[model samples]
Target chain A: MTLSEKNLKNEIYDFKKFYHLIKAFTISTNISCKAFNLNGEKIASFKGPESDTSFCKLIQKLNQEKNYCMQSYIYGGQQSEKLGEAYIYFCPYGLVNWTVPVIKENKVRCFLTAGPVLMHEVDNLLVENAVKMCPMLDKRRKEIKSKLSKIIVVDTIRVKYLADLLLKLAKIIMAEDAVDLNNKHELNIFNAHLVENINEIKRTYTLQGKNNKISNFQEKEANLITKVTSGDKEGAKKSLNQFLGYIFFYNADNIEIIKCKVIELMIRLLQVVTEVGVDYNVVSGIKYKYLKNLINAGDFNEISKNILEVLDYLIDCLTPLINVKNRNTILIAINYIRNNYHKDINLEEVAAQVGLHPVNLSKMFKKETGKKYTDYLNEVRIEASKNLLLRDDLPLVQVAFSVGFNDQSYFSKIFKKIEGVSPNKWRVLQKEQKNFN
Target chain B: MDREILNELTVALQKGDAIKTQKFVKIALKKGYEPEQILTEGLVSSMNTIAEKFKKKQIFVPDLLLATRAMNAGIFILKPKLKKQLFSPIGKVLIGTIEGDLHDIGKNLVKVFLERAGFEVIDLGNDVPVNYFIEAIKKFKPQILGLSASLTTTMYGMRDVIKALEKEGLRENLLIVVGGVPITESFATGIGADIYDMDGTKVADKAKEKLKCSNF
Candidate 1:
């Protein structure tokens, strides 16, 4: 199941119990912390000594007004869970906020935000403007000013470390709660009810929007499907999100219309799958199952999640076919290396040409060709040098330089390593073989 | 002799408690249990269970590695005593990761599995030069030479080793087995290797098969 569908909000997390556990942590660290659901609703909080500072209050007010909390949630939540890292950013008020996503089942269910801690000396003017924005804090101006003087400035490294620690603790708590809920059928019912209520509100707003601006996303859809078929995972996700955004933009609050549009999109995707030569039965089964999930999806997120899952499955099915693209990349790299064997070439340059990380390219190069990047390059250069060496008068140093090597000694060393003889010995041996033939 | 101590040794090996396994072996030896009986019933039998679980996907790489360590600990204590026994290994095998490739996890797993299956394994370790492999084969006179290279770049090292053997006329004297993530059966065959196993557990079985076919 998708993480959002896990109903983590309904999982009986005792805020009082958690607050008690982390109260000392917040106080000692001088960092105020809060947890929020995916919808930007605060679930619980731990106020540190600096929390009541006028600057802190002003920053919180500005965040609510500017929707910075929601922005941070969206920004941090977008990072893939596989990376297992938290997103850190500075709020507009100049205080650093670290957003740690609590991911479950490979989806972010909630976020633990720790911050308003200064990463630098407090800026008085920014603090003044914050106070001006929230005039209700005028009475506490003297106290706020005093507190801002003692503002705790933490290093970015420490902030990140703490954020990771909180993330681990949150994961442990979630796991423990999930295990506890396994035996509680009544709690499951309550969680299902809570999810239904949340989904009901989403469905109501979804159906209320007008259907307009449904442009021809057909070209974009086809591009997205191509990316999926080619096993461009990151590219496919980006395109899918953009395509879904366009669909939601025009057909917001309309589940029935969105469902039909999604089904149409699926059919187009299925055609691509068939062209890729995935088993017919598997393709049909996936299409049927995805359609059922899409139609029954309660919210936009659910529908999007279902679509992404189907895309992921199709990408997996197309993995063997995707090797054709990898083969092309390897061929292109090989050609580049061979054509440029007379000059300098390295893994990084060739990797950039193929738009892959050097390490990944290195691994792929070895897997596809059974030769290391440098080894292949050396082989090409050595072969070229052999042809140059055939001439009776070509100097060995010039031969080395002509085939991309800077030093005759190094080139000779590699040549002997591969051919099991020095260049001069190889020349004499080749001539001997020639006379025998 | 208390049979319970042998059972405890098996459990300790399964749990990957190397020190505990060694202690239990010492206890079993002091209790007048035959070293061969302890080796087979306690250590090898536990590795067999672990291998079976690994095949069934009940355990993973880390678990197998730990179990191997515990089994090795128990076997280390029994090796001296086993030397005096009339224990003949099924075969001798020399193995190493090929030159310019430092990956050895796969090679180590294969070596451990082979040793567990009663083969005398001479591990040449990672980044072994082609000359080292040839020299080791000559010195060790092993029936099988296993070449492992995880990188695509170093896989050619396997081919080079095979060619070197052929050049020295030693190729016919030994069965060459090749393995690694990048070494498929086709790649092994292309390199003229006698056997290829994707899973390290099956390497021992393949080695045995090759030995039987050659009437070793």
Candidate 2:
């Protein structure tokens, strides 16, 4: 099914022959001709006024009578007999009929038909018929003669030989068409399969990679900023520091476009890793001090000292509320929650840990995160619970307890309530669905 | 009489006194105190206090870095002799900047405090890709995998390391802790990363508490 360059070329070559044959027939017999392939695309035609649809309709008629009339019609040449079947007509202007069936695997894949030729070569035939049909045709004699002159006699021998050649050529065309189609089909299948896997692999790496790259930049940026701000001096010293800061910060911008490109390379890297994964720590670190300077010069409020700000910005493009004053209470609360999320802890304990009354801390939590204190606590707990669930060796009860719930039953209830499924159910579904390997 | 020496030792450490740091360590060790204890109680404690001051902006990263160097100088002099009985480490940690990323300031700061807080830290340097983390995990076999990413783009490499570790059956043996600018508790949770914190100073204690948990 894979499409190689060779098979494609052969199909094009076959189509060219079809085109030439149609043109040659038009010249030889001076009859308007057309060839429609199986898909109803007009592959060859000598019709100037007639549309592709007209030829397509004729082919359909020929196909319907393929069993009864195909052989007789091709052999009849210019003298083909016509019977009433919704397709046959005896017009003075022209008579139309099939040449031969272009069979593939014994089924017709295409048809060659010549049509709309003058039935009688006499100059007065159209004029006489038009007068019988309509008086206007008497005035249209020159036009009728011109139309009749275009319909010359069909040489029966040449017609039969050309039909035979076309039939054989159509067979070859169908064979090569099948080969090319199979190649295209397979290529499409392969591309879809590979593209799907590549996408999945890329998606997996991009999320994690974004976090790491952003954090690295944040840490490095902070360090350089700290260096510049702490060593602040007037005039030349400030300019030098600002210049260095600009260089460092600008490096982060330069890194933006490379993110997608590096992600592509990492996808390939991930494929290799999964195949024969390694376990080795090789430090190939790049120094980014120059990039930090650019960041320091920018309004510090636009940046966050917390690595997560950079991470959030890079991953989600979050614009955190810029503030001149540091939210120390939030920092303290966050630190306390992070340290004690796994322990048997509560909002009061966290409030106590941050030296705030429970009510005030609750309000502060909501103010900072737009959620109530207990909601934040539960959010943290459920988040941790999900991680523990991945470690299947841990009992569901233990996993629940590990994330701060004292009662396993309560943990399961809340976990299901938040996750919309019990921990065990979540674990089971996850296991059944994803190998995670 | 001993009060004078203790006061001078405290002042020397507080004032970024390198020479006094070595002298205080030598004198403290000579006075029947263990070198490891001197490191834990004197050298590390001073750095911890210095970190707090730095956090308050009273001291800067350079001042903190200088203090840590002073602390390291003392530790270096004491480390070989006290090799058999190193201070009860806060916890054994395998920390690194994830691969394809080279920003190391946050990681370095975390290392300073985590080590100062009596943890044995094996810092796999910046731009450490997933393979490095896996390798470090296998070699050091630390209970915690502390990953740092400075670039939002490269931070996702942590997931690769996480997956690699999981595939290797190493996740169960280790608590995967992540920190960086872009990393979130949600992201850590999303990727099944164990512990996520915003600041390097907090990461050490968070790792400590997590490691202490029998379940972790």
Candidate 3:
């Protein structure tokens, strides 16, 4: 459903109760939050009586140009909207803040920006930069310092956790009128880190030489069916790319020949994935959608891109069945992790949801998944973040924050420790690899 | 023989010190350093370090572009000297952005990458129409033609150029490599392009491989 159908102003029936709810949030977390409409006017802001955030309000009240703060908020909101999540960033005043966009009909109708906390120690340089916009602050340096000290010092991990919670919180405040606000599920681009596999296919095609004919189709289809049934979605897609690459290579000048081959292959795949044991209508729905796509495909290149999308959809439809049928606790937990890895989900919460003690969950998870819970979650987040890195328009910080990392520095450190190169460098390396033979 | 001068040159380049880097290159040349030695040690090695630093996030894009400018300046002082040596260009490449697209920074980067890899490049610049490409291809008869387009609206211009080349019977021996923001392998092949590479730094390698395997 489109977000405008449930719009922002219609979300809550009672403002007093909502204000108290947001106030409770501040009391527990020691962070201040303000929600704003599209025109840059405040809709709701709750300040806990126990803590003070006169620092930012004082800046807006005293500053010459009030638009800088709003501009930063706008920029941050645009970024979060792009990534489909909350974006944690350092504001112009060097305070850690996050913006979560509540989009409606593709426009940000409202947004919530939270946090003015200190991640690092406040210093003279930071204080000077913070108040440089106001000449009256020349005498108020001491006052600013004391107020900055009053701001809470938060760790990056806790910041990310709170921001993840705040994302849901923002949507909750905006979606109260809708039947289901969580329907906007993001598909995991299943061919995660397929750089090596894509190149391998190219190398194999080159090694197969221009003169060698694919004398038979049975061997190739068998190879793909093995991957698909074994739940190796990436391997299945790799086989598909390899299969399509050969067709395109051999028939570069003939679109009709390649289309004929793709149609024959799609008929075979319809039989293979149909065995997944979902309902008849569901399988038929998947069949109708994919068949229509392939039939409407314009060229061999279109087929190459769409077939991967088909695999992603089919896997999305079928994997739930596999997980639900198993009813294995470890498998269930892993499935849960895969679905929610983009959020700040922790072992304790997953354990609670799955009805296991935290310690047992940790032990069983390690024994089953062959890694610690944290490692697996981090790897999942890292794999997903790798997809975002390929887009040059995205900043390193936003990719980190969108994938549940709070600090760009820490993201780089972890990325290097895991991927052996920094994120941007890894991107450059991937682009350097030959994509087509 | 002061090897330390090359070290100083590298530091200057990484710092994006264009004047100091050129000064060091001229000084190194006057100190009787071989032109090949100065090119590799003072210029190429510094660009390599910048790439390495960028990969490690020790520096960022502004730093990288600044260092690239510094290295380009050093190359300005060193190119004529290198021509005196036995080293030579490996092949010819004709490149341009398609019509209605004014973006050329990516095209320029690919040009730099191809030049550094020793392919002689004849740049037709940006917003180029079809006939200019055909005329250049006929004149230069380069081994590869690189077509770039940043906008979806203009990317189809690459296809139009390829079709025009085929109509003129010039598509037989030429390899067409397509790239830019909107140009994917699918779009490349959809338009009958021979290769699609997004990375400027490695397009030269693909060109070299194609050249090696071809009759030319």
Candidate 4:
């Protein structure tokens, strides 16, 4: 599904609402429930009063690893669709679970699962097989055996009835959500139209003109392109912004024309970088695609932002090929920083490795790289930390320590100062953006 | 009937106090005020004020959203009562964010404005597939269809939906309006859309204009 579709689904099947609904149901019925997308990714789950059964957890873990639960959901979805009702069956764990496919326009969009209810006495043979399948369960043998004894049993007819009732309730909730969304949309449009009319009136009187200083514009653009090809990112960024400012000021009335001019500028910049030995494939691949996106940009601000990103990419791509006077020393220092960022290494050690005095090395680094030694080291560490943060398995403190910051608080403080958000928030944003994209 | 109670209800709605709005709605109903009177004077009047404030830049998106919530709180109570009376809408509209686009805040805002303008709106929700749009058009038989897409990649879906509508021989029957971050007037014209707006704020007026032109 597209990001918009996922968002709509999210809005329709509100997580908090579903969580509370399932929680309330669990409280009343002692039946745990979970919702999953078509991919079997658990959207939300609620634990019932009976959820702490050790045996159930073990079986669930095993089932997750083997994808037995997801398989059952898929099978159940097929059955539910075919029969035009919810599908209920005994899982491999010998507990009854029901799956309801939320069908829209003949497509199964999501599934609701409610179960792990024992319809009969727990069989000892099933337990033995589960234990054998997972030897780790041997350590919890006594706990599992005891929990197994406490398993509640219900009649098949009652279980089926409860499943059917829950499915109907889920359907009703979804329908109501649709109505609520429609209502909200209507209200928003009503408010927005009035604002738009006033803005349109104000815009009608705004004056716009073209800059007659087009004589030097091309020369200045060429210089900026040259800077990007030489890997002068800071210079290129400054020039790009100045050019955008000129475009915005002069062509404010005609966004489409400005968009066209910006695309032309980007293409010229790409050609210059490619001429400077940046791979043709890389430039060609992104140039037209980025140009298309730039052309489709909504307004001056969006177009300028896209152009800036393009310039940044060009500079990054050309940086390795740009020949610097102190390339050897800087490369050695950079290599050392990359390799030992996780350890306590000072500028003195790095300078000594490069056979230069610390003061001379620091000055040389700043002059050549446009950043101080400490800042450069921090950038390298921060970059490393970003990679570590991408892995959901790693805790924030571990990520900090793994990237050489012994103090998690200091690490988080530095991260926020650099990234504009806390480490955990950044991780979450990255994950959410990654999921949607 | 005390006019002050209706005034208080309007204030609650403007303040986005859902609980207070609901309370005042009940109070107005209990005071023997007709449901239609309460809706027009209490809820709709507050919404109009909000819309004007929004137009003058005195309030923004969050404020608009909250005010809408407040109005809905009152509307929910009045809906059942108003059902007993004849409450004909201006026209019906079907709206959705196109498939592969997850942006609906804009679309939702449009839906709200159209409804407030007395149009009966059927929102298909975001990331709606082309076939679903076709199916909805056929089922709702709306006077207008609004398609929204925020991403360049997904904006193509709007054109696809338009094409699908034409394929189903349903294109000429209804007015097609397209909007979103990436949608341009030129793009809309190229795709044979009847109207295009940059945002939801102007959609209601544009829809009204289209309806007038089509004599619907």
lDDT of 1 by residue, A112-152 (tens): 67776654444444355446655665576665667666667
Which candidate model has the greater lDDT, 1 or 3?
A: 3
lDDT, each prediction: 0.70, 0.53, 0.71, 0.71
The candidate maximizing TM-score is: 3
Better of 2 and 3 by lDDT: 3
TM-score of each: 0.35, 0.27, 0.44, 0.41
Clashing pairs in 1: A206-A253, A206-A254, A207-A253, A366-B152, A371-B153, A372-B153
Candidate 2 recovers a fraction of native contacts equal to 0.00
Docking class of 1: incorrect
RMSD of 3: 22.3
- Which candidate leads in DockQ? 4
Q: Write the per-residue lDDT of candidate 2 for residues A240-341, one digit (tens) a residue.
A: 223223322323323333233223322332233223322212101111221343234232212212221222222121112112111677788887887788
Model 1 lDDT tens row, B73-135: 677788766542338988899999987665565686677667766789898987799999989
Error of 1 at A166 (Å): 3.6
lDDT by residue (A32-69, candidate 3, tens digit) is 87776666566766564555677877887787376768
Preferred candidate (TM-score higher): 1 or 3: 3
How many pairs of residues in model 2 come into backbone collision?
A: 54
Error of 1 at B66 (Å): 51
> RMSD, each candidate, Å?
36.8, 38.8, 22.3, 21.4
Q: Give the backbone clash total of model 3.
A: 0
Candidate 4 off by > 4 Å:
A1-267, A274-316, A323-437, B1-87
Question: What's the candidate order when arranged by decreasing TM-score?
Answer: 3, 4, 1, 2
Model 2 chain A lowest lDDT segment of ten: A78-87
